[model samples]
Target chain A: MKRVKFGTSAAVLAFLAASPALAASDVCKGSDINILMETVPDTDALQAVKGDFEKEYGAKVNIEAVNYSLMHEKLVPSLTASTSSYDVLIVDSYWVGEFKTAGWIKDLDALIARDKVDTSLYFPALMALNGTVQGKTYMLPFWQYAMGILYRKDIVDDPAFQAAYKEQFKRDWRMPATLEEFAEVVKWAGKYKDMYGIAMAAQRADPVVMEATNYLFAEGGDFYDRTTWKPTMDTPEAAKAVTVYADLINSAAQPGALGANFDDVANTLKQGKAIFAISYLFLFPTLEDPKDSTVVGKMGFAPVPGKDSFLGAWGWAVPSNAKNPDCSWEFLKWVESKDVAYKRALAGGQPTQMWIYNDPEFIKKWPAMSQVGTALEHSKGLPIMSRSTQLVETFAEVMGSVLANNVPPATALADSQDKFGRLVKGDPLLK
Target chain B: MTTATIRAGSPGRRRNLAQYVFVAPAVIVLALVVAAPLLYSIYLSFQEYIITYGMGDFAGFANYLAVLSDDFAHVSWVTLKLTLLCVVFEFVIAFGLALLLNQPHLPGRSFYLIVLMIPVLMTPVAVALMFRLMFNPSLGIVNWVIGLLGIPPQGWFGDPSLALGTVVFVDVWHETSLMLLMLYAGLKAMPGEPVEAARIDGASRLQILRYVTWPLMKPVIMVTLMIRMIAALKSYDLIYMLTQGGPGKATETISFYAYRLGFRFLDIGQAAAVSFILLIVVTLLTLVLLRTMREN
Candidate 1:
């Protein structure tokens, strides 16, 4: 084993030495530009774009594919070192404030203006998510997803279940209209012997934060008051919202839901163990694909039932220290363009362009894409804040505590409020 | 006559120089790798360092103050409790196993030693993950087996009250093997003269174990306890995989807390501060243990 490891290391060194010379002569001009991208499931679609990008620009794009969690860790150290290891980065939407406030991302508003890029083609909600403090675009949408309810059509379509759902909610049983109605349906569906009524991404980290925030926002609770910079999540409505969610999970969600994340929830739905699930539009193609799912044609999508507001889509952004800002901006525009974006949608990549939802080819490829469009139409981005990361983290802890029944919702939110206030006042940059 | 005396000393000096040359590489490697990083971390512990993707800042002593005042005090207390509990449990179990294995004419002693060492040899992450699956409330083998015994399924890691204990159980499973191995070796090497003397003196089996065997094994036990305590205090991977310090921070340890502060929150300054504090506590405990061992 040691001998093999040594031989492999030597081979790698040799390859590394030879590749630079070969790359300089063939694909790139001047210096090789490294693009650090968050790993997405659709690698094939990205490779196609990479081929075209290299051919058009005469610049080599070194794609450093990293897991989302590690990407964040790597970003911080690289940024601190001021090492141009990554010319472009795909960051989470919530990270925009941290990156922008730190001046770690390049302002792309001027670049967008220079390119005469048409913003009308892009989803407005997705576009809004990329804007920084001064309404400057730091990133553009590469792919877009909105939170929606995924349900088993076979169960929801059953004659008796449909009649009961419609009678209870005063609707066609197609989609839930309010948070209360959603909880009722979940409880109603959970009574079945073979399936869980609902499954959510409750696993620790960002997934839990995302789901928890959706409910918090839906209940008209803000992480912090915009004017006073005080957290308002400890309100009665917020507690009510949290309790509603907790009750649903406690009574209707699958057992062992505490450790389940996006992948686990998706698997549960795909395996037909879950009657319904809350997830992003990205799950649509996979869940609808006959090859990948047992319930391919049996799954359906709906907008997340909202009490007062809906959550928006997640998009992409570029860092401020990009070496090849021009090329990266061009790539962003091309990717978000109607034609290219629609092509990507057809190939099972979610499109951030508004026109793709209307495109016949895209709709035919995956019918559930329309539900994403509907969700996006009504969605609202998270309340903008300088201390968004702290808010999200504290909120997750609060919500998780409530769900675990370790603390009442009101107390959890109160603790979060105190912590958020401390963080804001403590950090001079944020203030 | 003086020149001949100088020539006679030259070979001895050359031999000393050869010894230094042979040891130089190892010293150089240690300085370059271990010592450098340790010193760098100490330096960073004093600064409020932010490693943003493109920019960073340093604030002196702020990181330390934050960690000292942060919510991590509770987490630190919890970690200390967990470390003590796990270590105590491991020692008792391992020492008992060692005593049993030390008996003459014990059946398949070698086979038992191999079987017992397997848990210690397994990777902590793999073991944690396996236990996680086994403890799954819905489909886990543990729950299934319990059902057969007419017992209700318990939320092992899911329940906030049980999460820490569950992780502790997993840690005990993985770590007892190390203690067993160490104690076994210690037991095997124990002098038999003390036992023979105790027997001649008409000491009961328990009395001999307590008065003679234990007294002689004191140094070994102390050293093993110190080593195991240090290892337990630094426990991160197993807990991380098992609960991720979740169910409302019920299972959050100091090391996991530091990681969350550093990586998850991107509050490197606070993380550095917590780590330094942890270092101070560990160092003090280690010194006390060492002094006790010396006295023994």
Candidate 2:
């Protein structure tokens, strides 16, 4: 009995000695965490500043980056396991619903409250689209890609071309304000022998879906009726959007547009083979890189030619089965802090915070960022649900058919709408 | 019974137990790695197993019915076309090359053999990427070269009418080398007596090839075709890296469709059902080939 009492007292003393370290943020010290990340500029910026975090917390961070096409499929197996191989997951905006519904990612409300994270600092669209689902925060906004028009300033700004444009259209040449005007501009630009008009990424699966969604939004159409939970892709507006998108590809886009993805579009613009591209703002730096781009200083940026644009963004989340949840949370807090956000923005990564966009340094460095900031205010994100993958893939296939096989937009979309409706109906959350 | 006989019987029983003990690990490993997962997948095919939400209600044949009602017919047709085209073309090219390389007095045989083996040695994904770049409509060397002849630039992998043919061309390039090596090896292992007899009887080279060499090489040819056909049926990597089954699903095969269902769409039950259907098709083809082999 005496021996047992002495052992108990010793254990109590040991616990007391370790209490402070366990409670402190330094609890991340010596912890090793792994993150699944997408191959994007934001991830590059994170890698650049990783040594600072490692030194500050005495911890190790391992990031595995994969191309966007493979990111979701790669994450699924790991996330579904009882103990995830990844401590942190790079959550795309559309994945929020599925992740939250599956309980694969931890709810960050308590953690945010504990850390006093200023969630309001992030763009409301990013916050709503990327991390927050049904009033619960599950992720921290990492980076955002606002869709916009990138063009050759030299070609558009030339006096001779402007004069020719004025004569042809009987109006002064300016940035297009509507989809019809955009198509006319694209068609006019295609008249040059040396240049194609637009570099479109129209590959079947995700590329075309992303590019087509802009048209869908600008034309006042959506993938589905939110309130009724019915597919809206077969509407007249949706058909018109698809027809315009397909017409652009057939008449104005660079050769092999049907097989091109975002990278291909970037390359086409960089090679000076195309005059403009409907591209994500995240690709701006890549276009400006002197080593790869032939049209580095010749390019200009503007918002898409309509009120609505597609918003692309990613967020960081701690997986529910993370072995080092505290360390993961610590990493998220540090990465999403104002200082880091500023650093990331300066490193040519897209900023998720409103403050970063308004910073004087950023405003001076990237005049185009103001346009991006304005675009973000009105941009729309793809509908988020557990069945978004099916929705996007089905729509992508339909767009592909319209572009590749010359199927009428109405017929293809009608078929897709019927198929996608059945797929969505199977979603338990919807039911 | 005699005491000696009883002792001998005891030793025989002990020997049998020792054999089982030695084989037990392999059996257990096979059961764990191969049989267990396969059985589980088959079982899951009968249940509504969503990846996000764990296992749900018993689905019976609904998953199969659902998959069949989807893109099964189109993908099957594509897979069949791809397999037949690849196997037939690969056989013709590989057999011709094998014949040429089999000559005893052929010049630079070793150099030619090494050159032919390079594609076989290459990884499929790397080959696909290399070909994708080379076939890029705007920037690729292929279009540039064809331009010199005044032929209009073709959207090789981007055009729906051309995408499947382009994939088959790339597949043939990457796969025919392996077939060549196999056929060449078979030719080398062939008996010389029949050919010598045919030549002595005034049989022309073509006649000898048709009658003697063809008959002797029948079994090897069947096995090689069977192997190549099975591989063609399971083709996915090249399709993924080259075109991603794109241009309006023009090149999508059964294997890719199954992958899209499971990984991209996260419909595990339906994906499993598709895989089981593919397994059935492959099994039927393999049985037919085996039966042909037995008859031969």
Candidate 3:
């Protein structure tokens, strides 16, 4: 019934909410709720609207932003010690099972029932895979994402390079339409001595594995068999994917690609030093920012040239030890409302609702953003299990062995299969 | 094995309740700060305490056994190597610098000493970040310097072969100043009579340093080694920031390995076992140092 579009007239924002809902709840009206969020565009948008939220809800919302790598280190201790420090947490999809199984997160069904919230607003895949464990909702998918290819339009549109590429390949050079074509662009662009054709977050950590999963998906394999929860990394297709991914780093990628992560890869794109990058769809805003980016307005976005890619999500949940859960729920319900989702989208944070993509005004500025919806239909998140994060460690180890030690992909995959199999099977909770 | 002497005018053959009262707070603080965590870790080591999965089964020595196998062995071996390399290199360079700075003719000597200790004065996290930027293969000054010296481009933290050595180099750079300060103080505090006697007997400078200076500085050397080794064993912030134990776990010492297991993997039981193992090893090493240290 109401809307909060970014470019709308200022009078609309003032009149959007007929009555403030949070003011009715005494506990939420004056209480302070602390939110632990990853340092990302979402946090930035949240900060931008802090005064608005405080004024509307009549509560103090303290946001403690931290690097994504350190969230587990901070979150675990508080949950384990039962310290009611953080009322809300921005958690990765991979952590859903762990948090739910450990009883660290409060089941959200209670709040959903009380508020009569429409749970169908999120992408069903994200909701099912990220927010629900054993049919109980723990978190709401806040900023859902899938991997895409980000490349330099100005560089590829150069007359000389395009002419040369057309002459060499017998086709007009354009945005890559397939994985092979993408590789060709990388190799061709890499030939210039001063520039690297592609940048990859091949660092032997979560980033590398995240990128490599795209390869595995494109190759028609996965990290594990879905129904059995058994590792399939040693399968021929997955092994081939691992080899190609590693070889791409060894050859066409930037010199220090083996040690780079998503931030480095994004900066590589921003600096105009690389022609291509593969990461979350949310990377577009940073690349478009004129303040920090050199390649603003000179980039193109596409669904990853492969048939599939990672469909990751970061969700918001109330920790079981949350001191102000009523306040947290009051905030969560307000934020997930359709108007707020649209508002978040306009303010540079990603909105999880499927309908936001079809907004005519929003589409005028970001027509390419809708392609991600199609990509999400094909992509899959990491294996759903309490020990899924452990698999990230194994992937890093296996990929590192290939990149750093020259271990054959098949051998490395076999090793990982054994390790990950033990991890999934050996855990009593997983059983 | 040691004789006790009563102070002149002290009350004889009576327990000093006031002395216990004076020490009680310190004892309480030590128990809370050090002993409590140690006891908790021991208790956790025997359980399957995966924090995310809630209460655990009584795992007995299974968690401890897990720590003894697989990656733990590699982690322990790396810790030992790093401890030896860091302690040895820091001591040699620090002792050399101490002797050099102790020379009476050196101009601006105090200024140089203060400048040298800057690394130690800064926090390890800041130092690690600075070094991480420096170690960047393409853009970092470290590789730039190498290229200028007619050497080819090199990966510092990014190379599996060179990564451990690179962290070791950073440790020595940040810590050698502390060692230098300790040995310099020791050199100044040494008995002047023994050096004078050695000088009068026509001993060479090298001979005096070998026979007289080193033997007399054993107590200080023992202290330096104890503090440095313990710190090196517990080193985390530096490696965590710089490489996150990468180019494939090259610099993943025992402490980082345990942290990864506990925090990252959520396997607190095995992590506790690793911590207890490190505790035992450090205790034995400290006892060895004490045994040799008391001989003087």
Candidate 4:
């Protein structure tokens, strides 16, 4: 080890101090690590950063990216096998509950403490919701997502429409802040020739469930009672949520809302058709894309009008059977660090840090930072449970019945209860 | 020399040994690929097999009992209807087109046949997505063309009442080509002498088609029907890419239901039980077809 004395050598030391990944490379040794992630912007950003990390710590990284739908199929065999294939795994937040119960993940609290990593730098709510399972930090927060109401600011900002809106509703025209106001906007804007009130995924699939969950929570309803491990989707408020979801889909949303996903909703906004939509934060970047969007610099986002919006985020965890656990931690620490996360955010990745949300630099770049912060604070992540995945699908079918057919919301929810009850029967997990 | 001295058995034994030698590799491959998973599935059907938890509790007959429900009935009925509907329409259209192409001295027949058979070349997922975009109520070409006659924009797959039918239409669009190729080939192989003789004896085209052509086309139609029915029963890609058995399970067939159970629900035991039921249904269908052939 050599000591540098001032000036030119000091300049090199200052640059090294700026990059946490480069500085931390000396603390840990290197080996080969295979990482698993869904094919999303997070995967792209990680791949882009792979070269830098490999050079910093002499580790070869093999990244396996799969479509989101097939992630479970790809992960199950690897996790259940006697030997782990992937050293690092990115887990959808909902699966964290069961993963924790299975004891297939390494507890990272000691690692963070030893490395003196400041975990509080990340969003507190998401860190609590996604990373902590059973009061233990098993995963590090990566890309965070929250449901929001993205609106056509250009259209709403027009004086003609604003005057007409005020005359019709006896109030100022603005983005909706509550479910009633959301429905009213849907009805009010639906009569226009060019714009629909909202864009939604109301079909008989996963999209409907994702959209409806926000409504369920906004109305102060929930899917399960944690103490009893029982479903609660058939409650009066839940039933009302279903009805509202259906009514909005039928009268206020875009014509193809039935089978449309978030991509479609964002695309509709980009094409200058829809006035508003409730979707994840990833939709924001596409709206800013110059080549694809017709509504560039013309859209805005707000916290969805509800008690709370829906939240989803994926995080990196070291499999208990990791072949190179130390190298995996080194890569994970580098990716989740302040400098790398900031860089990743600039390159089409959603940053997970609390400072990134409040930073003056990012707030200037991101138009909806304040509203995003509010949404994150109010948002609720999907339930962490043994059968959480199926519960989502089951509720979707129930809600689909409400929207697609003329099934009464109450009846459809009851039918859903029946179906889910059959699933929960004789389950060891629930017991 | 030692092999020759080993056992000179009867001709029956020698023939049996020869048969075993020829069939052993195929049997071994089948056991490894097909029979192994099937046997494991049967074993798994009796246990609560969570992928995360490995093999869990053994609840005999519980999985089988759990799988028997109204959901199963609804899915099976949807499968039955879709299979029957697609097979009927595909056969009728394919047979009609085959007859038209089978005409004497048709110009550019090869070119027409090649053009008509394009759908089967593309993947089912691609075909389903193409139709999904085509039927998009906002900007689909379908509504644009139909709007010329003042028809309102139809929901197509989004309408619970019309979703299954719309799905069948997509399936027909992509799959009718297969039926046509098969039927056309069969038409060429059929004897023309009977039809020629009937025409010379003053029988009309309709009469010749009904009596002469119908009898000869039965076997071909049956084979085509079997192929189409089996394919329809196992249909997943189009439904997954289009409606996902949605708009309220209108297009939810047994195969999709079983997949949702296994993959989505993580109910491996119940999923295996559902698959076993489908296997039985297919076996019964095959038996009935074979019996019909024997009787006919």
Candidate 5:
């Protein structure tokens, strides 16, 4: 079998060497398929799916799971060459517009229609975010995520703290209702020497961008005007949002909060040093795990406190150039199935499907599951645009500058707006 | 007559031809490995390239323009200042250490040499990470130590004001050994006659060092400075592992900015453009150093 497989791969390489532009349809048969994917937290579940896939299709699936950070660096050159380095790709939902605009991904509408794929099984919010590009479904949401405030239940439930908190805030102490109240809570929590008011991932990448968007959404700032293709984050509301975020990180959060990314925040929460953390719903199960978490039962989940509303969520989509589009769609549909999603939930994968959220048994296994599901219902997705990546990066920089006290919020926001506006205006697609 | 002439052909020609053929393989490999990628990068710099997970584009000269006008200009200036500061400081400290080590009667010189070499020999990433942990504002050793002395805890890498200086200190600790070893070798190789002649002329030890020793060590010092400057300019690992050009781009050097553009932003064209600019600047500096060496 090894000899046969080696011989077959050699043949495929020779064929590829001869014809660089060979289509997937020409070479995707007889046990030689390559799939590229970014490594996620659910590697074990994905491996199980891969095992099932190989058995059913009689094709070898080569999964090139990369650190999410390095995945794009590898993918860009391949896309430029139009080479079939990967037949299937798992991409972040934010990248959909950019990939589609660049003509790197294939449209899967025909394939989905041909397969009679049902979009109903997936979470309505996730599906809407993933597939819709000017009213067209381009990709599928495989898994969904939303940002929420994870807190220590023990700290919040303390009777003395509750009485003091109620007196200070002049309301029944629950999860914060507004950014001002949240700030006050953080300050109050920080007064205790042992406890950090909040832990945040402020490192200069996706974490900063994600957290910035939460603030942006709360303050009612949008990334683009949609019609004019002009960046809109330079408004007063946006400036206020940036100022608030900067203050939160510099004053109210943990000492080393600037260097902390998502994993660091999770570890900080799990270690019980932080009283509160604004993080994705996906981290709840892991944070609650008795084997990993020191504060397993102490962790509590709440919707992200907003000046207005929630901002970010994750979605899964199949790329257009997938070799096994049929199988990929089937897997996606199956994963989104109510029964399968519920099973996954029981197995500790956060459910993105609406029905699984309604499952009493799944919620019983993980107490925070219901809270995550409820948070998802009201979650807001990132504003879609051709230059969304640039916009996000600029926003992060502007927010960082404001937080570091290098630039005033108004000036930073205005600078970001001008920079992003130029990018959008320069790009024909954005126009 | 032709056969007789052929039999007398010179061995030098044959030997030289053989030498050329032997070196040909190395030259070809070098071209493939280094020259080819360099040329490709140059080509890419001229084109606008956006690299997503599996997608990107080509817009000529746009990337270069963008990088030149972008926030990276300030970052490049910061890097320039850091490189200059670090190279100068490392040279002075290293030269002083070398002078001390050169003393014939110095105690435990070998032990001191080995101890000094340890920092340079250590893995750069590990060293940077260790410093990062030690410099943490809240729970780090630096703060703990300071607190004992009744000094308030300093925000070592966390404060934008202190981050670059902290990084420079770490760089100096990790790299001064190279300078020390180079200068020491130069000092050891120095002719004893020059120092004796200076002593006979009633020169003080400091006078001898400034006039005779330093002048004689000029070539070695120049080479060390050039090498250290290049290394400092390209300093990425320590800075990357330490601050990642953060606390609001206070510590961002050219290399870090280029990396962020290429890898993080997936803007390969912009990264390539920045790299080409860096290459040009370094090459010009190198040429200037070589010219000065030739003139001297």
Candidate 6:
């Protein structure tokens, strides 16, 4: 099968390259397809290999990439239309439930069964959170952004600081294994002049909520009780998480932390001004790039304290009214194939396939791949519901108030609980 | 009244009908592009149209009430504050510069005009992004520049207390140039006779400005203020780029609130209602401004 796929692809490529007029006996020959994707490293990797697909399928490919924040608003109008301009969409994990419920995306269960696609190859978190809604698969996992701590190894591993940390905390200085240890490290590292302990993306609305999720997960608190559909934010665990998260931002994080987003946080670490950053594994490539990062080769990755972090991911799905559904699925299958997934990972994408993390070549190149594999295994995603976006907004608002207004964590959590309770009161997915 | 006279009247009526035919496309296009979406939004405002779940039941005034009781009050206040601050500051500064630039013998007058209008030429998002970088508390040039003056670095947009003012400052920077252009044009268009007459009558510059120039510029001022106010009220790109209505909603405005509702929360009905409310507010304000203009 592999030989046939490669043989066919190579012949098609040669035919197209040799003569533009020569047409292949492929359904996609001369066909045009457009894809809407978020502007991430994975998207860039996919775009880099777009010519391969175009050549192999003898089709014209158009990719429109927008920032993750703008992707939803941009996709909604196209998706909700009677016909979509895009054949495929890179659906964010948070958007899966909404898109599925609205029937904006096609269910891929029958397609998967027909093709005998091994869905187990994808990270379980990605499959559960982004690829499927309930028992129905709506998308093929494209990329995963398992959240973790990307820290400056040189700074954290400094003998002087380590000794000082050991003396101060009565423990050997190492990667934090718990939330309390993380706080201790942050505070200790923050005391140095000209260097912030952590680069936090605590900007209101989305950034703060995304950053706060690590704390929430560490404390074993979620936005709500998933099983019972009740807000768990008012619990003591949630209050502690919120308090710790806020303290980290207000006390130990870089200047303007309240206004920082993922870009700012990454830049902070790249500039060598921060000792640590709570970031996604996907960002490791950019950090490792010598041209973009001043601290290249000096960074290390780890799962966030308590072994739980927010899992960010996106999957590729054909729109329900796609002009070329078959072509879109073919593109997905080709991209998710082991070789292509490996190529993408090598091209700085965070591939969704778990096996790629275990690849010797990938592990050698990205020393943190093993850690990333572990992080993905333990990560949690935002609750999937049609109304999860609203829940996030409410969470962002509460977290924003707490960070910016100095609202007490308990009060903020209580307020969020009420809001979440109201939001999820009739949400059918919870049951 | 003979047949010829009747025929002439018939031709005149036909000419009028022909004029309507000529304008029909534009009217239809406008109805489709502008009026259609607006009317649909108004309709959506009356329905429980969550974007995710698709259109729901007839919601009547529920969306409006929900918005009004929720973030509407805060965002409206924010919007009003932002509009007033931006328009007032922009007008004052722009008028001041306009008066200066209107001078017949001002040095580098053309250079100043070109440089002043640069902000207007730049996109609002670009301006916001530029200002956001400049205002970065740690790495930005603004903090460094201020530190040279023996001042400590300050969180400009990151601080809730400073975010709104920071946004207003950026808005003024971006919007003042247009105001300056308008007022300057109005100043140049003014007949110099009144000011000369006031001067010959031994009136001071301030006195002449207060009496003659002020009265003559009133209509232009009113029109400029109305336009700027409307634009300021509808401002979203700047707020979105700079703050995302952040630092705990300090910079959140009506338009941003509407966007958050519709796009972020998928509450299209409430968003539409909020938009209608903004439209109403703008309409009423425009009416008041027009009345004031007419009174002048």
Individual DockQ of the candidates?
Answer: 0.35, 0.67, 0.51, 0.46, 0.36, 0.73
A71-187, model 2: which lDDT tens digit per residue? 888888888776688877888887777887787887788768866899999889899888798888999988888888999999999998898889888999899998889998888
Cα RMSDs, all models:
7.3, 4.3, 6.8, 6.7, 6.2, 5.1
What are the models' TM-scores? 0.83, 0.95, 0.90, 0.90, 0.83, 0.93
Q: Model 5 in CAPRI terms: which quality?
A: acceptable
Point out where model 2 deviates above 4 Å.
A1-18, A22-25, A426-431, B1-8
Q: What is the lDDT of residue A185 in candidate 1?
A: 79
- For model 4, residues A12-109, the per-residue Cα lDDT tens digits are 44565576776556633456778778766667877887788778787778898865666876676687675579888888877786677666787888
Candidate 3 clashing pairs, residues 3+ apart or interchain:
A102-B52
* Minimal lDDT window, size 10, model 5 chain A: A23-32
Better of 3 and 6 by lDDT: 6
Residue pair clashes in candidate 2? none
For candidate 1, write residues B1-296 as lDDT tens digits: 99987865798877988899999999999999988877777777776555433224566787777777876777877798889889999999999999999999999999998999999899997998799889876658998898999996676886777888888899999999999988888888988888999899999989998999899888889889998888778778987788777776778888988888887777666777787778888888799788978897
Q: If ranked by DockQ, best first, what sequence of candidates would result? A: 6, 2, 3, 4, 5, 1
lDDT of 6 by residue, B70-140 (tens): 87888889999999999999999999999999987888999999999999999998898799889987779
Between 4 and 6, whose DockQ is larger?
Answer: 6
Query: Any residue pairs clashing in model 4, and if so which?
Result: A203-A258
lDDT measured at residue A38 in model 2 versus the true structure, 0 to 100: 73
TM-score-wise, the better of 3 and 4 is: 3
Question: For candidate 6 chain B, which ten residues in a row score worst on lDDT?
Answer: B4-13
**Regions of candidate 5 where Cα sits further than 4 Å from its true position:** A1-40, A44-68, A81-88, A114-117, A132-138, A192-194, A307-344, A426-431, B1-66, B99-123, B136-155, B192-208, B264-269
Model 1 CAPRI quality: acceptable
lDDT of 1 by residue, A1-431 (tens): 43553455446435644665553223234445576665554434565566665775576767777645556767766765534567666766777677776767666666567457776677677777754455667777666657878888888889888887677667776567777777887887777435688877676666777776667666667666766777687788788788887887788877666766676677768878789877777777677767867888898888777743445444445555445444455566656666666666677787777777787877887888777766776667655555566666777788777776558888887777778776566443345
Model 6 CAPRI rating: medium
Residue-by-residue lDDT tens digits, candidate 5, B59-175: 777878888888767887888889988998899999999999998899999999999999999999889879977886654799889899998666676577788899999999989
lDDT of 4: 0.79
lDDT (tens digit, per residue) of candidate 6 on A158-221: 8987888888889887788888778878887878635788898888777787888888898788
Off by over 4 Å in 4: A1-40, A57-67, A82-87, A192-194, A227-230, A321-323, A418-431, B1-15, B292-296
- Measured with C-alpha atoms, the lDDT of residue A105 in candidate 6 is 83
DockQ measured for candidate 6 = 0.73
- Rank by TM-score, descending? 2, 6, 3, 4, 1, 5
